[model samples]
Target: SSFPAVLTCKAAVAWGPGQPLVIEEVEVSPPQPMEIRVKVVSTSLCRSDLSAWETQAIFPRIFGHEASGVVESVGPGVTEFSEGDHVLTLFTGECKTCRHCTSGKSNMCQVLGLERKGVMHSDQKTRFSIKGKPIYHYCAVSSFSEYTVVHSGCAVKVSLAVPLEKICLLSCGVAAGLGAAWNVADISEGSTVVIYGLGTVGLSVAQGAKVRGASKIIGVDINPEKSEIAKTFGITHFVNPKECSESIQQVINRITDGGADYAFECIGDTGMITTALQSCCQGWGLTVTLGVPKVNPELTAHYGILLSGRTLRGSLFGGWKPKSDLPSLVDMYTKKEIQIDEYITHNISFEDINQAFTLMKEGKCLRCVIHL
Candidate 1:
């Protein structure tokens, strides 16, 4: 696959907070060394991209992180991947030199310049332009458009046999959810697991616990319809707060016999974080936080929860090391070991991006994918 030196591509632009994503024609660059220019075939909406504004990210943002595409071009020094290869982009690049990476946690790549405002790649600018004005890729891979450029480390090669449409999910929600349980918390066999917010991430956690041989998998969700697929994914107990006999915590306790051995808060809501902690039992339940709160300043609950051996922790990209985990995740998908389709409820064209965002806001779509 070859790429044009300069191409006009369709993209979603966020002018400011509380504004709708606008579709525009943005200029894309050919790949740079160790970089791969991808012709994105599919991209998915994620709350993290919307939550970036809380960090004070600049306006006119080019959002959308979970995406997949075909490698159009590779710059000098690139060898592992080539044109025509299917790949998914990771916003968090694997910087092996960083302590986080050296610690074998590539998911939390310490090299992410997320907080460095108005900064672009080493090229001094971005691969996008609007009316001759510049725009930056929201994450290293802004696949909201028809095409985008990303770092080599950010591009994870996938099984060629896997459809690019399905592989797009391995880039974000699917990876994050499974990673939280499989990598971060390490759900053990016969463990009692409780998952809050049965959206994509929460469900992924449930599947992880199931795959780990968890005997009791409890799902907690405010939406009654959320648990519709819970049992299919190995969830043994479903407690919709609306139908529960007691407080959310009590139901978890009653179901687990004392409390859950492991719990995951997939909803970034602060209130739910507290509930997630209290729902755990004595000294073994590990709670993983995979959601990004919309509120300003990273939220935290009462410090006492940390004293109960009810460990409270967070994970980025489910602690994924792109080069290693992405491929393995793709393998999992190929083998049908994990559930990715349950997350995507809708598919839209690139021009209907705002509609996708609207669906995401309404909670009508777990992942409204945009096909290029």
Candidate 2:
């Protein structure tokens, strides 16, 4: 089925940096070849979305990457999916022909990362516009709007059995966190795990560790209030950096008897990145960084940290190939192996979407599901 050549819909437009998204009536063009048009059913807010909103470099672009929706139309030559099929949007693409995708070593497919120029890869054009001015796509999904056109590779077909509102969390943050523990970190049973930051990602990490049979799960956060929620996800220990007279790393070392077997940094601050590495056990500890840093994306960790065999790794989309691994995550959620429904702290309407951001800024939400 094909949508009209043009359709008008409401979208939250990011006019400039450090500004509230203006909900505007925007025009969405029909999908070009190799693209598909989706009517967003539900989308969730992530810190990366917040980062893009605050950064001046990505202004004037639609900023949403995690969402689930139904297919409204399919462009020519699209065979993997059709109109009315339920789908989840993927910020990370998994074009099977790509070297990375074929090698099975990484999920950083070339096709997904190829659109850094802020336009559709097929025709190098913007599919959205307001008053004839083009709106650049954000992370290839731009799900902040009621409708979005994206590469067919960016849409993952999933079971209709799961509600779009509940499963949308798998579109990004949930998958990234679980994959970090399961795939990237390859967390082992009986391991000592420490996670910095008690947001959705960190809490998901705790769940992953529990699933893998980790004996000790420690959660560190500046906010002591997050301890209770973190505990719901299997966090057995909580460390408030403010309560310790010494450094948090030293505190963690004393608590873990030396250091944690694995440490994850989900706060997205470069300074925390260093501390996350140092909190790991010497000679065999592995640290994974799942946060998206807003500025100065460089780390200044001590050379001794690496010299002692503490490996530092960066996990994007939790190192899972979206098309292959994402569906299984949904299955996990369906089977009750992971928590998704519990993560939703708020259900918001499209007009009140900005309140989700406010809730995020105030550390009052785990994931805000925007009902489109």
Candidate 3:
């Protein structure tokens, strides 16, 4: 029996930071042990992808992680997924055997955790190459190409009944927001929740809060235009920081009659983390930070913030173990318990990939789905 041959396919390669992606033919090697090769059907642009494309030094890389695809082939010693299985690519994978994975308290899988060096966890090597020159992968999924190879733990098998294009959002943004609200914060009914940022992730948080029966879900974003669209996702109020005369935190405190019960920092700005904390009530107030900061990773807060009984927490991928948790999210989408299609503001082709970045930077779209 012969293995699948190396595949030469179209991939959007970024040669330098802030440079437009070049669509070129690249060789995708067969999956190594504990890996799988996938035919990506749909991929979406994420803020983290944009941040990496603009700032991260890892260039000449393939940038994409939120995606849905079908398994083209499975590598040796892998039995969880088979060829032709529909799946969603996960940036942070769940190697169920790890301590954190089995603890039932964390979604961070130590073995297949976040890959920052643009290579596979099993080996510090890339599967994508152009004329024998390596092209780094973005978050291991690299769905910007027509085909990509990912560790089996980094991919979740989903039902064929779900639309590959829409369900792809669950691979990252939507799931993150939903998980932050439900798992991390455990938002209670009738509580006052304020979310800083109204991107897909923030809106998903709003939706989760609404589903949890929160009485007031306030969405804070600089863009006033997002207010109308955000209402559909359960946001009861919208605040534009630029328009407010007083501090945004003051405004939130006024509306909530002291402070909101929960505040979420979803804008990826470390500066906003403090504001989120300030907007929370004194006792039992929880602030959850979901953003990936571009710089100034260090966080500073007045000692009184903690002394006053307020808690600050961090959320990654909405506390979801991709392989073990994403399937239930897929089910929630199918049952209309969640909103995936509402977040897709634009659908573009692979050739127009750069346009998606523009829309994201300009804050013109919620999510741009790229058909591969």
Q: What TM-score would every model get versus the actual structure?
A: 0.91, 0.98, 0.99
What lDDT score is found at residue 266 in candidate 3? Answer: 89
Writing each residue's lDDT as its tens digit, candidate 3 over 1-372 gives 368789999999999999989999999999999999999999999999999899999879999999999999999988999999999999999889989999999998999988999999898999999999999998888999999999999999998889999999999999999999999999999999999999999999999999999999999999988999999999999999999999999999999999999999989999999999999999899999999999888898898987999999997999988888888999888888888999999999999999999999999999999999
Off-target runs (Cα >4 Å) in candidate 1 are 1-4, 53-57, 112-124, 242-245, 296-300
The global Cα lDDT (0 to 1) of model 3 is 0.94
Best by TM-score: 3
**Which candidate would rank higher by TM-score, 1 or 2?**
2
**Which residue pairs clash within candidate 2?**
none
Against the unseen true structure, what C-alpha lDDT does each candidate score? 0.78, 0.89, 0.94
Q: Across residues 1-372, which tens digit of lDDT does each residue of candidate 1 receive?
A: 343487787788777776877888888877777787888999888877756633445766687788889988787778877889888888777756778778854456666423234334556567778887878667667777888888787777877789888778778788888888888988889888998887777888887888889989888877776666677777788888887667999888887888888888888887787888888887877778888776643565777777777788877778878766688888878888777887778989878777877776677778888888
Global fold similarity of model 3 (TM-score):
0.99
